[model samples]
Target: MALLTPEDLEDLLNKLRQSNETIKASTGKGITEICEEVYGTRPASQKVAIVPITAGNGIIGNFSSSLLAITEYFGLEGYITDHPDITGYHQAVSDGADILLMADDHMFIAHNLKNGKIAANHICTGVIYSEIASRFIHAGSKDVMVIGLGRVGYAGAEHLVKKGFNVYAYDPNTEFMEKAIEELGVNAYDSADHKKFSMVFEATPNANTISEGMITDRCLISTPGIPCALPAELAENGDIDLVMEPLVIGAAAMLYSVF
Candidate 1:
């Protein structure tokens, strides 16, 4: 995907804010009240402690700021801490945060916390596959290739399957490929066969994961991966439609789930 212009980002934020407002109006409650009704007794307070952990090198601050904007738009307090270690999570919990939030490479922190390695109630906000699936649905594509079977890619494939799309998944890791095939019932394909797809979901975190020759002419590439899976020259000049955005789309999804 292409980088969203400032105007596009602003418009998206406004739309999300409006959606939240509509939910509040229909439910006759605020975020905390809605959370209590749906998710049992979460902390009623509206504060999130953000612990940044390797949220992409230069774009960390930008990602954090976008998350803060989402929180503030929902009338929640966002406390962002600088430290990206165990200490930061502890500090966030100590700072009266209702939920500890992490993004990007720090996503593993949530799994660690769940496994009892970290003593904190946390949420990792980046399940962007649903967003990609929504885009694909809008584009009227029912068959697509998922180019990675990592956490995010697998989640995306699952979402596509739920939406009644034909999902063909690929990964160099056989174990991941097997899980996708067995659990999600996705078709397994070799990476060398990527060119066969007219619609592709590229979710590997490596640059140039989707090479020029691997992309079909007029393919629709939906990529939420970091460092970009498609090359810049191909995305700019080739016969393909590339969709991309900041990682905040996943953050918004997480926030909605929390509330």
Candidate 2:
């Protein structure tokens, strides 16, 4: 993932403004109803809060990931507490937090090859597909490659395949590869090949997985940084036309992007 320049940051802020406006203008159902539709029931209701615990250094690209800051905007209750021996999930449970918006390390970083081709934001649990698919559509890329096959990779890749993006996937996990192809209709490939593509969506957070020069010139890429995926490298490279940050945007939006 690349770093964000002042200009790029401005553009991102503009896109986010637009996105938020669109979100406010368009509405088909209530939040609880939407949650029920996705979770098969209303998310347990509780006063949500953020527990203090530093996510290890693996989550560098990600900054300011606490959902507590936005709880009021979302009509939720919450508090932030630094507590030892408390996982965010369990802490939320302990505090009677029915809805736990845990900070996700998985960040979505995209390098756009074309101007105005991609957008970046943090993806949350709300709407995962909205952010990802919107980036693809915005970039106008037809062929997409997805890296890694963990929970995020699988879901994001499957969503893209279902949306007809000529999705090709590479994962070290053969088991995951087989399941993704067999069950999700994605074209799975070996990770060692490093194929050229119009666009690559990387889900691995390890810095080694996606480094400078990993992609040929003019190829756009998205980095799903581990823990907190940030497009740090992609943003620094002049060749990167645009970058998308998915974790902050919402996981549900990412889920909605493909499927």
- lDDT of the candidates, in the order given: 0.57, 0.46
Lowest summed lDDT window (length 10), candidate 1: 117-126
Best lDDT among the predictions, by candidate number: 1
Model 1 Cα RMSD, 1 decimal: 8.2
lDDT of 1: 0.57
lDDT of 1 by residue, 1-259 (tens): 2232344455456554543443343334433444444334332345777776653432343545566776676567787786765677788767766656664433422222222222211121113433343343224456778888776687778767876878887899999988889999999866566446666777776788877655556666766676677887787764565555444445544554554
Which digits, one per residue and each the tens of the lDDT, describe model 2 over residues 176-243?
98898899788765446765554666666455455443354555454444433324655565554333
Span of 10 residues, lowest total lDDT, candidate 2: 110-119
Angstrom error of the Cα, residue 82, model 2: value is 9.8
Clashing pairs in 1: 1-242, 1-243, 1-244, 2-244
- Which residue segments of model 1 deviate by more than 4 Å? 1-45, 51-66, 73-75, 81-96, 103-126, 137-140, 190-195, 212-216
